[model samples]
Target: MSMQITLRRARPSDAEAFERMMNRPEVHAGLMQLPYTTADFWRARLAEPGGPAVAELHLVAEVGGEMAGSAGEDPVGPAVRRRHAMMLGISVAPEWQRRGVGSALMAALCEYADRWLGVLRLELTVYVDNAPAIALYRKYGFEHEGTHRAYALRDGVYVDAHAMARLHPNPPRPSPG
Candidate 1:
């Protein structure tokens, strides 16, 4: 059976749901974030507008009127030299996994990056063992960049991560003076 899900920009009011989603053991296990994430953290995150240049975008996935997942994009740095490059993060509920929730989020994000933001490079780091996520990223054109040993601490033990990225075919063109 297929489930319908909607994607929209995240708002401050979604802090609670975002918190709950991140607190799931399965979700946290795959991420570098520690357990016991607070709603206030998400609240503060959503409360701020991404700056004049839209250096970041946070999107929420809704399923049957419930917040099912989320995806975020931010720059690798604040300097002008790195403005065209960005980093990505995504998370989905256990129940929503393998059910198109991730695909929707990725699609929305890639569309925004390509059409709206004109980002030249989108990067992400995923656990090396996360086959599902790796495959999903590959489906969207991200290729393996490299591996980082002890890239993050999950559940109190160091783990390796694979760096992946998708370089936009048409990078943003410079404005003529």
Candidate 2:
């Protein structure tokens, strides 16, 4: 039997599940997140208002009413100059990896960025040793820009990362006035 995967805007009610996924050893190892984050932190963040001004998006993936994964994109900064770009992050449950959850989340994010937000650039960084994640980003058209040596500290040791980005394949043109 195959399970149907669904994607939707993340809700405050998902805080507990989000917290659990983020704290898992297999999950957080590849991510930049620090373990032991509280549910309240997720709830408060998810409860915040988001729209064009904020240019922030958080999406949750569900299979049979259970959380499978989550992904999000946020403007690199608050400055108007950076509005055309956003940084992306994603995490999938251990059991759901390689089961199309990541692809579904990436498709939704790309659709929103390219079509709705008019975003010109999307960026992400993955640890060098994470081959699966690197492959996923590459499949989404993210090209490696450079290597950031000693980029982050995970489990008490620094690790190198590859900075990757994807530009809007078909940017819309402004009408001549």
RMSD (Å) of each candidate, 1 decimal: 2.1, 1.4
In angstroms, the error of model 2 at 158 is 0.2
- 60-120, model 1: which lDDT tens digit per residue? 9998999998998988887889888889999989999999999999998898899888898
- For all candidates in order, the CA lDDT equals 0.90, 0.94
Candidate 2 overall Cα lDDT vs. reference? 0.94
For each candidate, how many residue pairs have backbone atoms clashing (under 3 Å)? 0, 0
lDDT of 2 by residue, 1-177 (tens): 787999999999999999999999999999999899989999998999876677789999999998999999998997878888999999999999999999999999999999899999999999999998899999989999999999999999999999999999999898899
User: What's each prediction's TM-score?
Assistant: 0.93, 0.95
User: Which residue pairs collide in model 1, if any?
Assistant: none
Q: In candidate 1, how many Å is residue 68 off?
A: 1.0
Top-TM-score structure, candidate number: 2
CA error at residue 96 for candidate 2, angstroms: 0.3
Q: Please give the range of 10 consecutive residues that has the lowest summed lDDT in model 1.
A: 48-57
